[model samples]
Target: MAFDYDQYIRGGKLPHIWCPGCTYGIVFKSILRVVDTLKLNRDDIAMVSGIGCASRLPGYVDFNTLHTTHGRALPFATGIKLSKPDKHVLVVSGDGDATAIGGNHFIHACRRNIDITMLVFNNFIYGMTGGQHSPTTPSGHLASTMPYGNVDPSFNIPELAKGAGASFVARGTAYHAAGLDKLISGAVQHKGFSVVEIINACPTTHGRRNKFKSPTDMLLWMKDTFLPAVAFDKLPAEKTAGKFPMGVLFKKEGAPEYCETYYGLVERLKKQREGRA
Candidate 1:
């Protein structure tokens, strides 16, 4: 049976703003499929995002959504998760929005181990904001701000999330649309801070500047470069030099979720007050 996307999509919001050959639409559909498979209630989900092309996603989804200031999506989502601990809070962010200006929040959110799922769209460039070099931009990559090629080393987002105490960390690419659905579903079901760094293509900016013949070429690169986690682990180190692993790279069970701990404290205080009375 064909899945009815109309129920999940916002009315009259079609003609999305993404450029031709952009893969955000594929990512968006993968997310929707995950939500449907989970049998999630739209009313019980809250999607939040900051300023970026990826951040525009929440506006098109029929859920409780927030489009906030640049680099502040985590903080806002944190608040929602803390206040309504039962709700499934998700954040959609870009490479620049998640790891550049929002870098501090990204790590701290992991440190706190909050129950929020963050999907980072890592196109390696600031696709919406003049094609600047983002923190994830590979060294020697071209961007509007680095026409001579970027000098800074790029961040490995999954490793960074693991180092910062995220209980769940995974990665997927736009080319592996089916795999992305599984990765996102796992992140959403995880009880503590979960980060899914989605490798994406920005043909208009990053691709054109970096000499990718077309978006198809960029996607093919993803298909070739990223290996499934099990397959990736079996390869010899030298053979895996330019490749990356997909699927859940790290997961720590039994970590205390931030909201649960805070609400537990509140309940304990209430009991103390009752004893005083």
Candidate 2:
């Protein structure tokens, strides 16, 4: 017997938009693992997404979902978290959508420390609306927007989240299937803002443009580049150049959730209106 994803899968859309060997499907499976491990009710969870290849994830999963404007997933998910306060909200988005176009919301979402889980699929290039130079697109990386090679440095997403007041932050590459499942599960279980940035491979645009002839080659590149916790601590300054590591970059407690603050304001207003009346 085989594990039939049809149990939770939203059928009738027989074909998916993702290219063959694209890593988004793999990431989706990991998310499903988290959803399954928690044994959560589909009615209690909301999967929100913005306009991108990754954004299409919500359409395939059986849950309360929203397909919002580009770069607005964080705010929309924030609204869901603040209003419902008890629902499990997750945002599935791409690097550009999460970090570039939605960078403002991303920053404030972390500052708010809302009880929502954000999974950023970082393939380095903007694959959905064409291969553009996204905020996380590495320095010297080639893209449609940066044909000559990108000059700006890339963002360290998990580290940025930690600095911006996110309660939990973790990095997981597409190659680390089981590792991602564990990290995502832990993040969803956490009570405050959590970000799981998955470094994935874009076989169509990034792969073809970057000159990788096959999918496995891109996976090898990821394997060669990724480092686990404390793996880069011993590396000297120059040796660490252009290197990117992935893992539970940082996490801590004591940050107040945004819903708690919102409810406090609501109660305060109610008492104020009563006194005036």
Candidate 3:
């Protein structure tokens, strides 16, 4: 029997507004599957997002959701996590929203190792803002702002998250739907900061400009380019240079969670004050 997806989505928000061929829907479904498999209570989950195409997800999902300012999703989610450490907080953001505008927040969140799961929809271009060149747009890619071809280098999101001290780091693509669900589940279960970057295609913008005749072509590219970590590890450097490896990339245990540490410090300060009095 097929699972009822409507249980998680808002009844009034049927027929989402994403463009045809956009793979954000696939990633969203993966998230729902993870939620179902984990059996997490909807009331205990808080979904937050910054302004962008991907940011609209929280509005459509039935949960405690926050649509925050551009580049500020992480900080807002941080406050939520700090206040109610028992609640699970999730952030959904696009490449531009996460890496370009919210870059500082993203890194800092990782540094603190706060318990929040962030899923970045990396479609290479800024799909919401007229397909401009985003921080993750590949070099030589075409965008509305870079009609002549993108000259700026793109960011390797997984590496950045690991460097910033994220306890869990993983990569998934929309084409690999099952893999995305697994990665998202792992990220959510982790006790510290976790980042899962899902590679998707902005068919309307990135595809047309890049000569991908259709959105399916872009997805096929993802299916071919991204490989399982074990298989990817066997390839030569030149052969694997541009390919993305799927599955968990990094995970560290025993790091003290930020909110727990903060609360402990508060308790210590209170005790000291009481002793002095």
- Per-candidate Cα lDDT values, in order, are 0.96, 0.87, 0.93
What ranking emerges by TM-score with the best candidate at the front? 1, 3, 2
Question: How does candidate 2 score on lDDT?
Answer: 0.87
- In terms of lDDT, the poorest run of 10 residues in model 2 is 1-10
TM-score of each: 0.98, 0.92, 0.96
TM-score quality measure for candidate 2: 0.92
lDDT of residue 270 for candidate 3: 100
**What would the per-residue lDDT of candidate 1 be over residues 99-203, giving only the tens digit for each residue?**
989999999999999999999999999988779999999999989999899998989999999999999999999999989999999999999999999999999
lDDT of 2 by residue, 27-99 (tens): 9888987898899899999999998899998998889989999999999998788889989999999998998
Candidate 3 per-residue C-alpha lDDT over 86-149 given as tens digits, one digit per residue, 9 for 90 to 100: 9999999999999998999999999999999999999998888779999998899898999899
Q: Give the 10-residue window scoring lowest on summed lDDT in candidate 1.
A: 1-10
Q: Model 1, 67: alpha-carbon shift in Å?
A: 0.4
RMSD values for the candidates in order, in angstroms, are: 0.9, 2.2, 1.4
Best TM-score goes to which candidate?
1
Pairs in steric clash, model 1: none
lDDT of 2 at 249: 77
Q: Which sequence of candidate numbers ranks them by lDDT, best first?
A: 1, 3, 2
Q: How many clashes does each candidate structure show, in the order listed?
A: 0, 0, 0
